[model samples]
Target: MKIASFNVNGVNGRLSVLLRWLESARPDVVCLQELKSPDERFPVREIEQAGYGAIWHGQKSWNGVAILARGKAPIETRRGLPGDPDDSHSRYLEAAVRGILVGCLYLPNGNPAPGPKFDYKLRWFGRLEAYAAELMKAEVPAALVGDFNVMPTDLDVYAPQRWRDDALFRPEVRGAYQRLLDHGWTDALRTLHPGERIYTFWKYFRNAFARDAGLRIDHFLLSPAIADRLVAAEVDREARGWEKASDHAPVWIEIADG
Candidate 1:
């Protein structure tokens, strides 16, 4: 099975590019983040016409996530992250596809450090870690895929020192990310290219993409069982250059059936 993750920035604004990517890449399953639309505003029919079924949780003008699977209806396993029912951000979605469970997360972008936003980012990380523990107990084949907003190491960034003060590069944020890995999930991209500085997101400023200035925030964390089935991993860099493209390129991995 081939699975991929892409942060479209805004599904409506970049529908054409999204459609083109979907058509070209042809992944078996795709996890999308930052749809930037409310539930009612989601273009469900258009998406369906592209030969996929999706389960989405969206909020107006902000975060949202969805999973689209080819030739399969996404049976929603979870919509919002647990441990904080009051949290209203549409940042988490889980589904079962091809007998494997997958999760999509748009982790908070806690910029402007040493502030409430950063605090909330840490809090949400804690909640997600706690919630992941519960999922681990289920012992099901699974993968956690999305833009984590945390760079786990210097090797994962273009210039580790340059990003140290940024929220995504903060020590606390990195530690929280480590805690998630401690639960036994595997970072598929890292596993594939352990020593390479691979990145999935590039800032729009200063022609970041043109200069190859990017961050490896988007990820695919696999359970041990699923990790064993991994065949390869890659980032579709070509997608980033498409017209009206999102800042993020797509990351994909192939898995073998048990």
Candidate 2:
């Protein structure tokens, strides 16, 4: 089975880009983030016409997430992460697709460190850690996939010194990510291609893409039950080169049928 995660930036604005990739790649399951639209405004028809059924949680002009299952409708599991009833951001969407529990998340980009936004990012990581523990305890085949917004290690970034003070590369943020992996979730890409310089996101500034200066913030963490089935993991680097492309490209993993 092929499963992928992409931060589309804006689902409607990039509908054509997304549809084109879907047609060409034809991933069996896809997790999308950064819809930048409200639930009512999601381009459901366009997605459905492309042969995928989706469930999404959207918020206006900001964070949102969704899951798409090819030739089947994902069984909706949850719309938001547990442990934060007061938190209103639409950043998480979970579903059951083909016996796998898929958790799609758009983690907050805590830019301009030493600020409230950064604090929120840390808090959100705490919430994610808590729920991840629950999922591990459940022992179900699962994959937590999307834009994690953190460079887990210096190797995951093109230039570690440049991002030293940035929230995404902060020591604390990296520690939080490590704690998630400590819960027995395998980092699919790193596991498959250890020591390789792989990246999934590049800023529009300073011709980052042209220079191959990028960050590997998008990720796939599979529970042990499914990690053993991991066959391959990769970044669709060509998608990032397309016109009107998202700053982030698609990352996908192929797993063997048990």
Candidate 3:
């Protein structure tokens, strides 16, 4: 099946553009992030009308996530990342679609490093790592796809040196990501296009998109059992160029035959 992950930034603002993309791409499943609205505020009617059903977790103005499936309602499995009772952020959502377990995450951005927020970012990564390891034990066809807010390598950014201080490309952040790989999940996009300089997000200022000044922060990690099914992966660049567009584009991957 075809599965895609996209950070729409704001559903209310990018509804029309999102609809257009849905009509064209026609992915079997989609994991969305950065909804930036309350659950009540998400446009359920518009999305349902587009022929995709979803399970979402949303907050007031930050860190919401959802999973959408074409012509079917996803089976809700999780609403938030594990490991904390008080830690509430609309950052994680998981569901089962066609027997595959999928997680859509909006990992902490934690910009302006060397502060409390960055610390939280790393702590959150640790929690995710632990949860990922636990999921690995299940031996199911699982895939975690989302805006992880991490750049795994120098090749992922237009200029690594220029982005050293950025939250996404820091050594600590990359190392944390590597730890997840060490636990046996496959980076699907990297498996398809190893060492490539493709990016999924671009800033609005400075003509970042036109100049191709961007970062690869969104990703999909498949369990070893399902890794063999990893197929095509690409970033839908045009999705970021639409009116009132989101800073992020969509990244998609096709799995083996059902």
Candidate 4:
């Protein structure tokens, strides 16, 4: 089965691009982030017409997440991350599809660091860590996929020195991500393409995409059970070059069917 993740930026605005990709790529499962729309406004009809059943957690003009299963409906598990009742951003969604538990998330972009936003980002990471531990304990075939918004290492970024002060490349942020991996999640892309510079996102400025100046922020973290089934992983870099495309390209993994 093929599982993929993409940050659409805005589901409705990018509906055409998304539909075209879905029809062409035909992933068995897909996790989408940054819907940037309210619940009532999600283009459910359009998505259904594309031959996928989806469940989405939408927010007004900001963060949102969704999961789509081809030819079937994903059984909804959770709409938001646990442990934060006051948190309102629609950044996390979980579902069960074809016997695998999939968690899709859009981690906060804590820009202009050393402030409240950065603090929130760290706190959110902590919450995610706790919940990830629980998932590990469950020992289910699962994958945590989406735009994590952090560069895991110098190898994952271009010009790491220039991004020293950026929140996405900060030491603390990367350390937090490492701690999560330490809990037994496999970084599928890195594991498959070791020592290679594989990137899923490129900034729109300074001809970043043209120059191939990119960052590997979107990820697929699989549990040991699912990791054992991993067959291939890759980034659809060509999608990023499409007309009116999102800054992020689609990242996907194929696993042996059970």
Deviation in Å, model 3, residue 249 alpha carbon:
0.8
Q: Model 4, range 1-258, lDDT digits (tens) per residue? A: 999999998999988889989998999999999999999999989989889999999999999999999998899998899999999999899999999999999999998897899999999999999999999998999899999999999999999999999989999899999998999999999999999999999998999999999999999999999898999999998899999899999999999987
Of 2 and 3, the candidate ranking higher by lDDT: 2
Give me the overall lDDT of model 1. 0.92
Candidate 3 residue lDDT tens string, 57-161: 988888899899999899999888899878889898999999899988889998879788999899899889999988999788899999999989988888889
Per-residue C-alpha lDDT of model 1 across residues 1-258, encoded as one tens digit per residue: 999999999999998988898999999999999999999989888888999988899989999999999977788999888888789899999999998999999999998998999998999999888887877888889999999998999987888889889999999999998987899888999998999999999989998999999999999999876789999999999999888999999999999988
For model 3, the superposed segments whose C-alpha errors exceed 4 Å read: none
Off by over 4 Å in 2: none
Which pairs of residues collide in model 2? none
lDDT of 2 by residue, 35-112 (tens): 999999999999999999999999999999999999988999988998889999999999999889999999999988
TM-scores, in order shown? 0.98, 0.99, 0.98, 0.99
Off by over 4 Å in 4: none
Tell how far residue 51 is off in model 4, in angstroms: 0.6
Q: Which ten residues in a row have the lowest lDDT in candidate 3?
A: 9-18
Tell me how candidate 3 scores on lDDT. Answer: 0.90
C-alpha-based local distance difference test score of model 4: 0.94
